[model samples]
Target chain A: MDSIFAIPLISAIVSIAGNLAVFRKASFLIAGVAHSALAGVALAIFLASISIELDYFLVATLFAIFFALLATTFSKFSDIDTGIGVSFALAMAIAVILISLTRGYTAKLWAFLFGELFLMTEKDFLYISIALVAILLIFGFFYDKLIFFLFDPEGAEASGINTRLIDAIVVAIVAIAVVAVIRAVGAILAYSIFVAPSAVAKKFSKSVAQSLIYSFLITLICLILGLIVSSAIPISASAISAFIASIIYLLVAIEKS
Target chain B: MAIEAKDLSYSYGKTIALENLSFKIDDGEIIAILGPNGAGKTTLLKCILGLLRANGEISVLGRDPRKDKKVLNMISYVPQRSSLSIDLPIKVLDVLKMTCKEIDSEILRHLELENKLDLLFRELSGGFQQRVLIARALMKRPKVLLLDEPFNGVDVLSQKRIVEVLERSGATTLVVVHNINPVLHAVHRVMLLNKKLVAFGKANEVFRRENMVKVYGAEIPLVVCEEGVVHPLYGDQHG
Candidate 1:
């Protein structure tokens, strides 16, 4: 029952925040940070067995933020994609090592790997809701400035917009959003929902507001439809949702071409 | 002086982009900066705008652009059209909205962009895109305006409109152009640069064969029109 409500809610939040990331050209950066978040989660689980207490969400958020800053620093001297690729690889390796070091949490960790929506408790939903609210507030307050920066960075800087600060804030927000949703949908499916809707919306909409609306609607529809289809045919909801999103993107590409 | 630079210099690691350059512009004068690719034309503009930190002193409107960010309220910049993200889903109106709280419809009508407000920026032709950029700059009612490669990819008609707008702007304008023939008549003076200040004076006085050779490393053919205006015949060398 909670899965029914949680999937659509999380999807809505990811679409809006994800589309903003798309505008900033930080989609892959989100992926890299999301992977780093996994290492943080695994480390927390491993530490708990040694009788050391650390909040997994706090550690994951910190790890993702660190990866975000690292990727940004790497991007300064090289292509952004290359920086993100390196961060992604390093984080994945660390996560595997940490997972190997842990014991008797295989079932719990596996649920995080592919996302078990049915396992979400009320507390999980509340935490994600707080993240959604934070994303909305930050984006809403800085919408015009962010749009100006994304449109023309040099112009924004000349206008005294503090573009570097804006860049840092944007990547940090994406990092937070990725960490919040990674466990709910897993890394792979999180990326699909984060990018696919915005990519499709960019083709269909003529304005930023229109694009945001379209992206949100597309994600919500995919999540709800995935749920309905999974109920009839015993399939994983996250897999079905991601598959539907990909199919929509492919169809959009073919039609546009 | 609307802008002044004293021995301004900048280097990117080992490569010196600008070297010991000093010049000044009177208020409301339209000066065109001419230089070949990598001649530090854009870098000079960035220095004046305080986007890049330089070794020497620079001032705009009696304020150090790097030290006093309040100067930004009285200045505007229109970067090259190519610098913009080509696929953003932003409308002409959206770009204007970012500049100020209210859109000056008068500026829109002047640029002939009022009707095109609903169109996405990427959907517009190159000419219209340049106009929109200029229009966005003008909306701030700046005391100083800097434009980089405004003529690139623009049609002849849009170029004319751009010149007209700049003429009426009454701001201290510094425009960087590759082919100065199009804007030669509109500019009050020409500041030729090739990593260093080559010449800064009236176009006729500055376009001497030696000046052309010194900056461009070649003898650029010069033509004198009926009005005795000197026009340098050279292909556009934008990068």
Candidate 2:
């Protein structure tokens, strides 16, 4: 109802939809992209202190996209996997820590790292809504092709699908989703939303479409429950959402066992 | 020619997988490519399908496969079983529906997979998975069909059914097999390869003692039966 609730709802939608597109392996890429956003934030803060007056969201989105693209492209061209590209995240983490120490902006850095959803501005709400719409449209249009590629890449390519282009688009969607929700879920907690809900859905679903629907429902439940719990107690909403996701995953695993 | 390759060579870094390979397939002909392990059998298929970048030229349906993607629409490729992950949560009918606009009920009935359309692909046995892959390729009504090790894990009955289906399809079919016995009667010609085109002709002409020894690096005794020449080396292993 309120614009404040729109932030969590939109984040849940983006997380569920993005996870459905890339599946669980995408969470690793999200972690890499999210952590890499720290470098962009550091650069933005540095530029702002000198009166350059740039939008931090734009800088962080561009930087995170660059790092995400670099990681995927490097892994594809070389004989390595996406895990090797995660080194960029570690490097950015160190850079952000050093910059915060020297610039005495530790609180600002923590705001990005831990997330503060209560401080979401009207502009942030608009950006999240636009991202959710974009994600919905892209996934809706490419749903079948994406499923084909994910199920069997060789078969998809053999069937005249542009697998490389599709792969790049998938990575771009992931980068955008991470950038859109980084402020609400934080760089550290965002991966849980992308991964845990999908993991639970997979355990209960027999088809890709079913898994997608279940993932959305599970993420929405977790986000709403986390919001309620955090309202009554002194706790982080993002942390509570992550906790709820993990507890659901555990419950599903136990039920399956 | 439905498919033509001129001096097509491919290398994995410094290691050469295929070298100076040249071949042609007539329209509506069935050809089986036989080779030992790492003889570039799969590499040759990938080059023809434009899945790999080769040194020389390859034209499928009179267009360069590497330059033009339109040729891919008329061609269907069934890769080795290893290329597919069985554990994916996808239904048999869903796989067919994704690859083709309409399901060919006749092909499904022939493959005996019509009843198992709703089953998860992973739940099927190895033989059924291969049949499903074949059925998926056939659903496209492709002019040029390429299969890599289609009988790797298939049972004898399914193998016979696949051979019969390919024989009746009338498509330009190129199949790569480790064993040449099952497909000997079905294939119009056979191509033997060991990093190079060793032999290409009728099955009787190519399955000689010297060519078999050259490709397989061992003495392979052939038995002339009512069906055809059976290479004891590969034929009996599956039986």
Candidate 3:
């Protein structure tokens, strides 16, 4: 594979793994975290304008994890539905967008929102690689436990699985993976890549392991296809990737029906 | 005792689910927890399993269930069939593999699920789903097995098969059921509850007319059939 394909390959790996781990378990929350990450990106930009240097990926990951945790806690403790957390995320996203405009960081904001896949720096590649490795390692170590937890939480808890801790770890891993790939597939379109392939794979998979493998393959195919089409035409790569993912999902769904 | 609870109480906000519930189960004893819809049968099981916080004390295998993680390894719980989603693309074997540390082929054979291992859980009938859940729990060879509504959608033949398997396994079993007539012969003890311990004794002692009326708050038609005792309010069965 060419060095040019390395970044998107890593992004696809992380997207599929994170989506399988988190999206299947907490679908709405992943979308909420993806949108809420915009607030973190805005904050990082605002800090940079004030002559402070920080890792925007780390900042965005922390913010997304915080929002995810907040939502999980509220849903677990209070009578409020988990979807209520999505409203908070949307509110934060809008607030940060307005703040970014006021600070004259509109161009930077658009890059984070729509993504500039071709502009991925060497550092972005390194960060995504580390995230991919970390995600794979965690999943490898806790594959059975995670599957048990996701399949039957009550049964897992009864069997001494520490489901609450597992849930938090899953959310954090997803948050980091989503933030790490934001440069390759923007905050706005990240959820599409994260969920679509996994959802499609699940339609035909008979086991968790098979579902994961199918998810990775589907995501890689969509990424490669999107990159090829966008290179030929004057279209956004991330947008095309998102479109391909949705098309694949629809095709699978139609076949199933 | 395999399981013990003292002054156990749990409430959801202002609505009390269980109040001052106390019980003890000897090792290898099969006990059925009989109660109405909202009598906190599930709540009691959750408390014992440490899934829900409750006031007072609960000990499983001589350790506080809330403090010791090892207790869980020795306990197998089958939640209500409705609490699980069969639509997920999970095979019956996949569920067993994820849950049991060591699968017992004999238990699977007893439940007649050995042949259905490759089937998707969603494709099984309700009775077969319950059998799969039971098979998973039995595969663990747990010291204590807790089942909530194990026979809700189960048919008569499957129910008999399940009771026979449980009776032979000799695990300290606590089963929560709305009706007790099916497993009356298999159970060593019967616990009647209505937000509190109403009756705790043998099936004949707890299944009396007064205790039934007190627990159910209405007249429940009961009869002595060939199967032992039958609660006609739930269903009819032949032994």
Could you tally the backbone clashes for each prediction?
0, 0, 0
Model 2 ranges with Cα > 4 A deviation: A1-4, A15-26, A77-87, A90-94, A97-102, A254-257, B219-222, B235-239
* Cα-based TM-score, every candidate: 0.96, 0.90, 0.91
Q: List the residue pairs that clash in candidate 2.
A: none
TM-score, chain B, each candidate: 0.96, 0.95, 0.94
Best by DockQ: 1
- CA lDDT, candidate 1, residue A213: 84
Q: Write the per-residue lDDT of candidate 2 for residues A49-120, one digit (tens) a residue.
A: 666777777877788778877786677666324443665756486556657544656677677787766567
**Residue-wise lDDT of candidate 2 within B1-239, one digit each (tens)?**
89998999999989999999888889999999988999999888888888898999788999998888888999999988887655657899998887797999999988999998999888899999898889999999999999999998789999988988788788999999987767878888899999999999988888799998898899887777776554445546646
Docking class of 3: medium
Worst 10 residues of 3 chain A by lDDT: A79-88
Residue pairs in candidate 1 whose N, alpha carbon or C atoms collide under 3 angstroms: none
| Residue A256 lDDT (model 1) | 92
Write model 3 residue lDDT over A1-257, tens digit each, in one string.
23265545554565555555543456656566766676787777877778677787887877888877777777766532454365545647664665655466668878777776667788887878877787778877887777777777788888888888888878777777777777777777776787878887776778666667777777777677767887899888878888888888788888888
lDDT of 3 by residue, B1-239 (tens): 89999999999999999999888899999999988889999999899888888999999899988777787888899988776645667888988877765778888888898899899887899888898899999888888999998999899988988998999888999999877767888888889999999999887677778988898888776777675654435435333
TM-score of 3: 0.91
